[model samples]
Target: MDDIHAPTVASGLSSGIAPRDVSKVSMPDLMQEKERIEAELSALSSVLNSHGVNMNSSLTTFDGFPRDDIDIAQVRTTRVRIIHLRNDHKAVMTHLEKGLHDHFARLQNAPGATSANGTTVPSSAPTSVTDNSIADTGTLGTPFARVNSVEPGSPAHQAGLKMGDSIRGFGSVHWLNHERLSKVAEAVQQNEGRPLTVKVTRKNESGSGTTELDLQLTPRRNWGGRGLLGCHIVPL
Candidate 1:
């Protein structure tokens, strides 16, 4: 974290660019913006760590007096900035998802055709739904783990994962192969920077029953949070 200077929270914790029409932006540009926000968030987290505090750490004692061990002023300011950056991160991810969807749509309508956004598709651009389909969603499998909490702006949140969602499958690690959740950790490690199909069952909006959902989650380090998924999971 010290390798990268912590951003000044007061200067604004946005992605360091003016808001533009996301539809008009190219997919690559959107991805770059996402990376930028994530890096800043990671740096901010390091700053908080240096101050010996976390988002949940109390800044005051039981008597409501400011604690003496840590910098209360800095901790409060950093917390606020992290909140703002998390919101910004979520917005950028939304735009990135839209860009990916639009990219795929254009490709389907015209195979190997130039992107509608007019930027030359990079050779490194992902080609398959399994690789980059953030919107490719469906339901399958049996429950193995349950999402107890989802952190805002974390990869789980970016992928539309929610609290109380029951994890039915995670990539190749299904209910049988999960090995008491160890395989889930292994899958996340092995698939860093690559999207993994996460199948989950959640209560329907109508509240009558449950429905399954498929989400593409990419895990990466230093996402300004504690874990790559920014979520807490427990075995069913």
Candidate 2:
């Protein structure tokens, strides 16, 4: 009886970064595969957070909900949930496709992605959720890392490093890669440990144009993590 209740699945396949389909499997297989997928996704929750879907868009906020679609007086929570997931499934598939493509593409680009040594290519490791201002985040015209959100007391935060500022030159190099900040810090002591200079650019609100600015910052002391600028930096 329990086996009869499993969702039917189709054959596993790929399409434009499509999520795996398991429709051909039996009830037990479906349950096992679903569990497997869920387990595989657990390590990347930060990158995989599925906020409630906004049917109105990936580019716009969902201005309204169809709450009134059902007669509230008779609708049950189970019914509401089922309906919501049904509506959200399409959107979920779209996002999944996009994510899978990105993930695989990155793997392909990684060193040794094609050969055993390919994946082992010598590369600057990525920065943690910490300081990344070491690299040249300065740019001649555009801002550096997409300023998703800036902290309240960090140097940039206090100096008016508002959200959306693209840091271009750190001390004198591009921080676009985002790992330079950490690399620069490791080399700072060798370079005299002076206060670092940064160049930042951001869009003009009026769309008139972009503007450039300069900032000076010293590394925070006793930082808990490598390359952390002692600021709360979140991805945009």
Candidate 3:
């Protein structure tokens, strides 16, 4: 059987083997594996981003595209790596979830386990653990578009848009599967002369944490700008 089809330790024991308990897996080890998979995925995403492509974009062919500017062979290779990395990420996540479940189950079954409030903690007590480190993996309901440039006195400029700022969401354009940035264009055209909310993530000059900005931009033509947005946005 292929490696992909092979049974994993987390998938229970194979034929003629004793079933290994998930509780044997340490939480720290599971967390580390999760972080490693996330890092690999982030690295693959960066490679694709350098080529102006998102993880969701199909790279079937480079015809009529910037083959001269980008390394087509490198892109192809990275695409395959991304597929494998995504699969590995999924598997790791499954293992981590199971480990966490098993750990919490043991905790609840402990002899004298009680809540801080002196109440008996139920086994079904929320096992949900939030990891803030993964919060910036992507924006929710926001499209991540990089501002190429903003025309002076244009709607984008007037709205305080600057180059390098990532548009987390603008009007109806959210980060959910906005690989092509077509939603930003559609939002602009559909909301002309109307106030549109734009959320952006701007890197601080100190190179510390990012700053989130909520700007209201009114899209209009004849603002001495070429496009309705008055700013070039490229998918990141």
TM-score-sorted candidate list, best first: 1, 3, 2
TM-score of each predicted structure versus truth? 0.44, 0.32, 0.43
For 98-180, candidate 2 gives per-residue lDDT tens digits of 43344445755676555455445443433321234323222122233456666556554655667777766556544222232
lDDT of each residue in 47-117, candidate 1, tens digit only: 99998878887666787666788876677777777887677667766666555556655554674656569
Q: Give the local distance difference test score of model 2.
A: 0.43
Candidate models: Cα lDDT each: 0.71, 0.43, 0.65
lDDT of 3 at 101: 57
> Cα deviation in Å at residue 99, candidate 1?
0.9
Candidate 3, clashing residue pairs? 142-174, 142-175, 143-174, 143-175
User: What is the Å distance of residue 173 in model 3 from its true position?
Assistant: 1.7
Residue 114 error, candidate 3, Å: 20
Candidate 3 — worst ten consecutive residues by lDDT sum? 5-14
- As for model 1, its CA RMSD to the true structure in angstroms is 16.6
Between candidates 2 and 3, name the one with more favorable lDDT.
3
